[model samples]
Target: MTLHGRAADAREASHLAIPVGSPILAGAHRWSDDEGVIEYGEWCLPPRMTIGYEYQP
Candidate 1:
């Protein structure tokens, strides 16, 4: 999924996606501090549950 506009909104959406298909809890983060800066954000899959993405840009 591609999200536009505020990055915070996009980060929120990524968190909501982790539970699809009943995946095991891995780890996630949205590294935004009080400085109002977002450096990185990502989520992980269980060792047995791997996923791939196709990027065309």
Candidate 2:
């Protein structure tokens, strides 16, 4: 696959992995590179508010 194609595939995979109805905390994490970037944040379930990874892929 080409570089852009690979990036898009990764982005799609990350979107698919997240559970529905989770609340995401903005700016929880960040990443950058010469070609592309991705950010990871935190999300939580209600009541317990268990933290989980939120991906911006």
Candidate 3:
């Protein structure tokens, strides 16, 4: 069994995501300081990732 962690919106705000190919999004996940231990079944992203800025060019 795998169990992930979830923080509040305010607390999760600290969590940043690693930039895939953009410098602006570089090291974004470093902002989160209240990160709790997470256990993911598959560390890889899902087939369809949540592209918040998929349209950005």
Candidate 4:
């Protein structure tokens, strides 16, 4: 998994309901097993939104 902050493009802006070039949080993740990749995805979040994750090991 990887995350970064970048300016929203036109497509991202439209779907996120934010103006183009606005700052946004973007991320992509990949999950794989022995055979091959099981899942992969990319996503963007609005600037004002907050997201968190907790790991227990």
| Best candidate (score: TM-score) | 4
- Order of models, best lDDT first: 4, 1, 2, 3
Clashes of 4: 0
Predicted candidate 1 versus true structure: per-residue lDDT over 22-48, tens digit per residue:
434344445567897476554444324
lDDT string for model 4 (1-57, tens) is 999999999999999888999999999999999999999999999988988889899
Assess candidate 3 and give its TM-score to the true structure. Answer: 0.17
List where candidate 4 sits over 4 angstroms from the true fold: none
Candidate 4 TM-score, C-alpha based:
0.92
Per-model TM-score versus the true fold: 0.26, 0.21, 0.17, 0.92
Instruction: Name the regions of candidate 3 deviating beyond 4 angstroms.
Output: 1-28, 32-44, 54-57
Q: Positional deviation of 16 in candidate 4, in angstroms?
A: 0.8
Residues 1-57, model 2: lDDT tens digits = 011111223333356454443333222344667866665454222222244467897
Give the lowest summed-lDDT range of ten residues in model 2.
1-10
lDDT of model 2, residue 21: 38
Regarding TM-score, does 2 or 4 come out ahead?
Answer: 4
lDDT, each prediction: 0.44, 0.37, 0.31, 0.95
